[model samples]
Target chain A: MLEYIVLGMVNYEDMTGYDIKKYIESGISVFYKASFGSLYPILKKLANKGLVAMYESNHGDRKKNYYHITDEGRKAFEIWLETPIMIDDGNGTQLVKIYFYDLLQEDKRRELLIRYRENNVTYLKGLYELEEQYVNTRNKDCYYYKLSVLYYGIRIIKETIKWCDDIIERKDLSEI
Target chain B: MLEYIVLGMVNYEDMTGYDIKKYIESGISVFYKASFGSLYPILKKLANKGLVAMYESNHGDRKKNYYHITDEGRKAFEIWLETPIMIDDGNGTQLVKIYFYDLLQEDKRRELLIRYRENNVTYLKGLYELEEQYVNTRNKDCYYYKLSVLYYGIRIIKETIKWCDDIIERKDLSEI
Candidate 1:
C-alpha cells in the first residue's frame, strides 16, 4: 500500500503495478516493498477510494493498467505523510528466526546461519547498485538520503553475518 | 498478528495479553511491533485455526484474556518463522514530505517540518536506547549492526533537522 503510494508520488511520474514491483525490486525500495499479491489488492482499493485512477492501454497481447494519482489521492497521501505512523513488523521474522535458531538441529542451524549471511550479501549487492544510481543522478540531497538507508542495510547485514558466524563458531548459544 | 503468535508460543507456558503487550514495549521488539489490534485479531484467528486456545478471567473489574499455544500453533509458528520473508519499504516519505513542503502554506510547512524533526528525534531516542541495550547485552561483534541502525536514524534525523533549519533561516521557500 505504501510502496505504490510512495512510488506514485516519488520515483517515476506515474507507474503500473508491474512497473512499481520492478522498481521496488531494483533496489530502490531497500526500505519499502509491495509484493504482487499486496500490490494488486492495494491498487484496486486505492482506485476505489478515489485516490488513484487507472487507464488501460492496448499493447497487442498485453493490456497495461497505468495508475496515476488524483488530487484527492495526493492530498490523502500528504495527510498520511504528515501523520505519525508507527512501522510494525519492522524486523520480526529475522529476530524470530534467530530466537528459534535453536529449534533446528545444530548442523542444520549452522547451515541456515550461513545461508542467512549469503542472503544479506545478495541484498547488499542490490543496494550497492542502487547507491550508484542515486550518485550518478546527482540529486545529491535525495541521493544521500537513499544512501543513508543503504548504509543502514549494509551495517545491519554485516552485523547479522558477524553474529551468526560468532554463534556458529562460539561453542555455545547459551553462553553468549 | 505476529505479536500474538510469538506471545502465545511463549505463553504456552501461561501469560496474559497485558504481559504480552508489556514485553513487546520493553525493547524486546525494537525492530518489530505487535499492537493490541493485531494481537487480538491474531489470537482469534489462531484460535479458529485451532492453533491457540484462549480463556478469560475476571479479576477486580479487569478482564485478563490469556492465550495458550496449542501443539498445532507451535508447529505453525515454526513453519511461519522459517518462511523466507523479505524486509523493505523504500518509498521515500521523507522526500515526499520535503518536496511537498512547498505545497503547504509557508507557516504550515515550516511547522510540519519542525514537527517532522521533532518526531525523528523521538524515534532516534528509542534507537539510542536500543543501542545501549545491544551494547550491554551483546559483544562488539553485534555492535556495528545494531549501532548502524541507531546511527542511521540519528543521522537522518540530524540531517533533516539541519535541512529544515537552513531552509527556515534562508527563507528558501520564498522562491517557491
Candidate 2:
C-alpha cells in the first residue's frame, strides 16, 4: 500500500523522500499518514525493484536523492487504480471504546464524550478551511474529482460532529 | 490495543481466545477485528502481566484456556475508557486514489467512481440491517451509546456514497 502511494506521488512529479512526506502531510494527512521509518524503507525497495529510479544531486552541503516513477511503475499504478476500493469500516479503536464505555463512571463517560465531540468540531473546522482555500485558489486544470475528495472528507467530518452531538444529547436525556 | 480489547471482552465474561475472535467477528467486526495469531499472544502477555487470570477447563478430550480480567485489569480498562476517542479519517487508500485519479483516462475514472459508489451502497445496506437487528433485540441492559457507534458507521458510509455520486455527476458534466 505504501509502495502504491509512493508510486502515486512519484507519478505526479519527481520527489525526494522528504518531499513525499511533506506532500502527504499537507494534502492527504487527514486520510493517511506515514512516518519516515516506513517511508525510506519502502522507497529503497521500490528503487531496487526498478519501479522507481533514484538520482542524486549535490546542493552545496547536502546530497539529496529524488525518485521518479518508471514506465513499469505507471503500468503497475494503473492496474492498482483499477482494483475496487474496499469499504473501510474505519479504524476500530474509538468504536471499541464506545462499546465498552459502561466501564467508566457517569462523570468520566461524559467527560470523554464531550472531549471527543470537541475534537471533531475542531477537525471539521479545519476541513472547511481547507475546502475554502481550494475554492479560492481554483486552477482551471485542477480536476474537479480532486476537490471532490476534500468534500468527502468534509462531509464525513460533518456527520461525525452530528453523531457526537447526538451522543451528548442522549447522555443528558439519560440523566433526566 | 489488542490487549485492551481482550481485556474488554474478558471484562464482560470469561472467554477463551477462540471465543473472543468469534465475538468480535459477530458483534464488533464492523469497527474492530483480530486474528487468533495476535489475539492468543496478547492474551498470553496479559496473563503474564497479571492483568488477566488464565483458567484451564476440560471438555471431552479438549483443553481450553479462558481469560478472566483481574481487579487491576478492570481499573486499567476504566482509565482507558475515559481516554478521548480520536476521529478516524478512514482508510486513506481510497481517497489517495481519488486524488491522483487524473492520471487515468476519463472512461476508466468514471468506471472506478461508479464501482466505488456501488460498493458503498452494499455497505450501507448491511449497516442498516445491523441497526435493525439491534433494535429488535432490545435487551434492557443494551446501552444506547453502543448502538450509536453503528450509526456512526452508517452515517459515514452514506456520506461516502453521496461523494461518489457527486464525483460521477461532475465527471459527466465535464464530458458535456
Candidate 3:
C-alpha cells in the first residue's frame, strides 16, 4: 500500500524521497504515516520494479535522488484507481484513493464513490444486525465496551457515506 | 499491538487460536484484523515471554491448544490500559483500547476518554487550519480530492470525539 502511495505521490510530480516524506506528513498524516526508514526502502523497491526511475540532482552541494513515475507506473496507478474498493479495506486505503481521484476520469470517480458508498450501506446493515444480536444476548462482561466499538464503526461508516454523497452531489469538483 | 490484543482476548477466557481469530472477526473486524499466519507466531511469543500459558485440551477427538492469560499478562494489559493513548495512533489502536476498557477502573476509564477526546479536539483544530490554508491557496490539480480526504479526517475525528462524549456521559456501562 505504501508502494502505491509513493507511486501516487510521484505521479503528481518528480520528488526527492525527502520531498515525498514531507508531502505525506503535510497531507495525510492524520490517517496515514510513513517513516524515513520505511519510505526509502519502498522508493528503492519501486525503482527496482521499474515503476519509478531515480536520478541524482544537486540540492546545494548535496546530491539527492529524485524519483519520477514511469509510463508503466502511471498505468499501474490507473489500474489501482479503477479497481473496486472493498468495504473492509479500512479508511486509509480509501483516503489514498480519493486523494488521487483527480487522476481518474470524472465518470470513474463518481462510479467508484458510488460503489464505495453502496458497499458501506450494505455493511451498515450487517452491523445493525450484529448490534441486535448483542443486545439480545447481553451476556458478556465486556458487552458495553464491545457495543461501544461497534457504535464507533457504525458512526464512521455512516459519515463516510455522507461524505461520498456530498462529493457526488457537488456540481463540479472545483466548486468547493 | 497484536500482542496486547491477543493478551486482552485471553484475559477474557482461555481459548484456542481459532477462537481468538473468530472473536476478533466478530468483535472488531471493522477496524482490525489478524490472519492466522501472523497470529500464531504472536501467540507463541507471548507464551515464551510467560505472558500467557498454553495448554492442550481435547475437544471431541481433536487436541486444541488453548491460551490463558498469566498474572504477568494481566499486569501488562493493565499497564497498557493505564497508558496515555497518543492522538496519531489511529482508530484501530484506540478502538482496541476501548474494547478492553471494562478491565480499567471507572476513574481510569473516564480519564482516558477525556484525554482521548481532548487530543482529538486539539488535532481537529489543526485540521481546520489546514483546510483554511488549502482553501486559500488551491494551487494543485488534485485540490478537490486532497480537500475531500482532509474533510474525511475531520469528520472521522469529530465522530470519535462525539463517541467519547457519549460513553463518558452514560450513567453506567450496563445501562445501555
* For model 3 chain A, the run of ten residues with the poorest summed lDDT: A167-176
Against the native complex, each candidate's DockQ, computed on alpha carbons, is: 0.07, 0.17, 0.53
User: Model 2 off-target regions past 4 Å?
Assistant: A59-62, A88-176, B88-176
Tens digits of per-residue lDDT, candidate 1, A35-153, equal: 79988888888888887888998779888988888888776754443332222334422232242233245666566656666765765576567556546765554233223434444
Error at A17, model 2, angstroms: 0.8
TM-scores of chain B alone in all candidate structures, in the order given? 0.42, 0.51, 0.91
lDDT of 3 by residue, B14-126 (tens): 99999999999888877788999999999999999999999999989999999999999999988987887777764456567888787777888899889988998999999
- Against the true structure, candidate 2 reaches a TM-score of 0.52
Clash pairs, model 2 backbone: none
In the range A1-176, model 3's lDDT, one tens digit per residue, is 78888999999899998999888877877767888999999999999999999999998999989999999999998898788778776444556777878777789888988998899899999888888778888865557777788888888888888888988774343343
Clashes of each: 5, 0, 0
Model 2, total clashes: 0
Q: How much is B57 displaced in model 2, in angstroms?
A: 1.9
Cα error, candidate 3, residue A90 (Å):
4.2
Model 2 preserves the real interface contacts to a fraction of 0.47
Highest DockQ model number: 3
